[model samples]
Target: MGVGLYLHFPFCQQKCNYCDFNSYAGMEHLLPKYLSAIKQELFLYKVHVSVVNSIYIGGGTPSLLAINDITTLFDSIRRNFYVADRAEVTMEVNPGSCTLEKLKVIKMNGVNRLSIGLQSFNNESLKKLGRIHTVEDFIRTYQYARQAGFDNINVDVIYGLPWQTGEEWQDTLAGVVELDPAHISLYSLTIEEGTPFGRELKAGKIKKIDEDLEAEMYENAVKLLKANGYEHYEISNFAKPGKRCLHNQIYWRNEEYVGIGAGATSYMGRVRYTNVKEIPLYIEKVFGNDYATAEKEALKLDKIIGETIMLNLRLLDGFRMDDLTKRFKTNIDQLYGPTIKVLSNQGLLKEEAGMLKLTDHGLMIANQVFQRFV
Candidate 1:
């Protein structure tokens, strides 16, 4: 398999309340320099990677770039990497940031998939989340993407908001199903320490929904999406048949990929590393030294096995013991048989037809199961 390439654009028009990513707001002044730094960073990886099968342009809203800048970015990628002809090229877009002209330009430059950030269909919820777009803006953007010839599209939604109700959650699912996007990603809200929601939670101004209610919301989403012909391929992702996000599958399968731009991570040659998070520092290091790695770790054999199991179990289909043995050249059962047996007896996991998978109950407390391997 060829290496997957991920490029991060860290600029957003306005940062959302719940975001704690490497993204920043009001960085428009640095756009030109940032793109230049990204191109330079891509060049530094040319000697290391020979073939790239997938290119994911994720961000702080990559659609916020200007027309010419987008074209230039793709041109630089082609210049530096041997991109496959049938590569899955995906770009993350926000509703208010994309226009019909911009979408057309993006398509013409070879982006075949788009992951739109439509966190909620309700205008009130959108406002509460500090989203810049409304229901109308999202609808218009989705329509524009379809008109621009993108058939494989993914819609991102979040459940478990501070004041969300079961009915409202169902309505969001129904609304997205009506749109019939090729894929859907469902995420439960997590209040990280530095985000606005986290502060509100700390101040006791906002409260998390009841744990039971959150689980019910997830269960309802699974049923509703499946009934609409979407496959629950991953724990948090649903897809129409043959439309799964290929780049993410690389990570889940514990394969190698290269990451570019500020705060991006790469797993190559059995070593994992992340780039510097600060934009100015990233630019300086990339231009001055041709690399901007901030931290790295070389994996030991046992560590690799543990991490591989942790990532693969996220797929609903699970991984085979035989496959694990073959990949790592070791006896899988000898290493983890006892833990598996214990988990199975507790009804948190099951093994059937040589495949090991999570039971329905296991999916709810997946973190606990993963902790066993860790």
Candidate 2:
């Protein structure tokens, strides 16, 4: 089985008010050390990983990385890893950070896919979300990416923003459909505890939208994107036929992948581990050849099965019971037979074709079903 490689870039021009990702705003100066440490971490893999089918350069805006650093990162990957010829290499780009010159260089250096984070089409919503890019800037950057010869594109949009009207939400969907990107990721806004949005929410300065309103927005997205020829392949992802994200699918399938760079996580064999989040410490440790590993856990069989059930349920196509039994040596029902039966009785889940999947209503309150397994 081929592995997926994830490299995290934790530098951004500014942090979004809602972002809780392990990214820093004024840490651009740490790029060189971070890149070198990532390269070293790549060689530290002891397992005999033969081929890689996907490489996702994700994070605090990978497009902001210097061209030379980008080239060096890819060059090291090519030299050390047997990357497949048609591997889906994706990089996340933000509108304000991407330039034609930089994007072209990244594209030419083996990046076939670009995921642009365009949270909203409304300039007012963009400002409210503390996003640096305007609607026009996103348009220009997207057009520039296409001009740079990227055919496989994904656009990420968020709905249910504070005080967002249905008309505004529909406009955002229409704008994305007009772009016709190969893939689209639609998400409802969630308030994380430490984010500015969360603080504002706690202070009663900002209010969370009603659950019914959020559900309506989500349902609208499903209908609109499906009508536009995009398949709702995952709970939050839609793709044109054969354009589903392979890297993310690996995770959904509960397969192993090595995540490199600061604040990265890796799942190899039965163990799951994460790298140190602190940049200076990560650099020092990797340079010291300790791989900057912060913590590691050998997941128990029950926990693994719980993870399998939780992750696979997110996919629309679902997963095979026979395959899980083959891999984990555990019967399907033993893992969550009682819970599945309860959910099925409640019309939150359905079983057919030797596979189990979430129902339409189940998708609305997926967290409730997911919590049972956890």
Best lDDT among the predictions, by candidate number: 1
Query: Candidate 1 residues 71-153, lDDT tens each?
Result: 99999999998999999999999999999999999999999999999989899999999999999999999999999999999
RMSD of 1: 0.9
Q: What is the per-residue lDDT of model 2 for residues 126-226, given as tens digits with 9 covering 90 to 100?
A: 99899999999999999999999999999999988888888899999999889889999987898999999999999999999987888899998899999
Window of ten residues with lowest summed lDDT in model 2: 41-50
Each candidate structure's TM-score, on Cα atoms with residue i matched to residue i, is 0.98, 0.97
| Candidate 2 lDDT | 0.90
Q: Which stretches of candidate 1 lie over 4 Å from their true place?
A: none
Query: Can you list the residue pairs that collide in candidate 1?
Result: none
Lowest lDDT 10-residue stretch of candidate 1 = 348-357
